[model samples]
Target: MPCWFTLTCAVLSIFAFVCVLGSEVNVQRKNLLGLGSLQSVAVSGRLICLGRPAADVKVKLYESEVLLDSKLDEGRTDSNGVFRLSGSKREFTTIDPKLNVYHKCNYNGLCDKKFSIRILVDYVSSGSEAEKTFDIGTLNLANEYSGQTTDCIN
Candidate 1:
């Protein structure tokens, strides 16, 4: 009976130690700066296709002009034409950093339509993260047509 009591006490002490260790690990993760430190941000937008709500359209996100996080990382939109990208946010600002997205149609030589999406990048200052929405403003996305030029005889 004495041996059993000692073993039980030992087990309890181990469990307590594990709990304390877990709490410390969580604290460390939260302290990490940059994108990892961010919790989440709301990305809502309207699907624009032919100057209208292009329902079921895919949205994407980029970091430093390169693709980092995408709309697929979050989820798809609904019949209401609303989509969101939620995940660990990062500092994004005119002075903080820059992110760009390439509209698929704009890359092809056949399409001449301009497509653009809004990206919201959060900036962490001191201990708080501030949210900023980049409209990408107005863009005249052009299609690169690589072909021979035609000449007519007079």
Candidate 2:
């Protein structure tokens, strides 16, 4: 083959190899963004009281029987009382997710005493998917409060 033809062939081969490698890298990136083999858990619900949505209620998740703040995931209900809390772990082991809700149903001006409701969810795992979403359903704060202790905010 002529020298010019040989050089052109080499350059084309290099370009094709680079294109394939770039596509593989893009796929790996998507997997890292929760589209691959990681395990995940999602908890979502609505806080309702007096037949209406309760907004600004503090919701938190913790490991069953563990109350350390460092391991807690927290969020507040939106204006429509809808909240979603999610977490993921690299391991495939199951986890017991607990939810603690704090709210003042019928009081005004940040009542000195807030009511709390604790929910102990069943053990859940992500299976073989990258992530799984679990819906805990709507929580009626007014009926479930039970006048529990007020340490949820602290």
For each candidate, how many residue pairs have backbone atoms clashing (under 3 Å)? 1, 0
TM-scores across all candidates? Answer: 0.34, 0.53
Scored by Cα lDDT, where does model 1 land?
0.41
Worst 10 residues of 1 by lDDT: 145-154
RMSD for each of the candidates: 15.0, 14.4
Best by TM-score: 2
TM-score for candidate 1, please give it. 0.34
In Å, residue 138's CA in model 1 sits off its true spot by 13
Model 1 misplacement above 4 A? 1-36, 62-72, 89-154
lDDT of 2 by residue, 23-66 (tens): 87776577567565444456778988888999988877654433
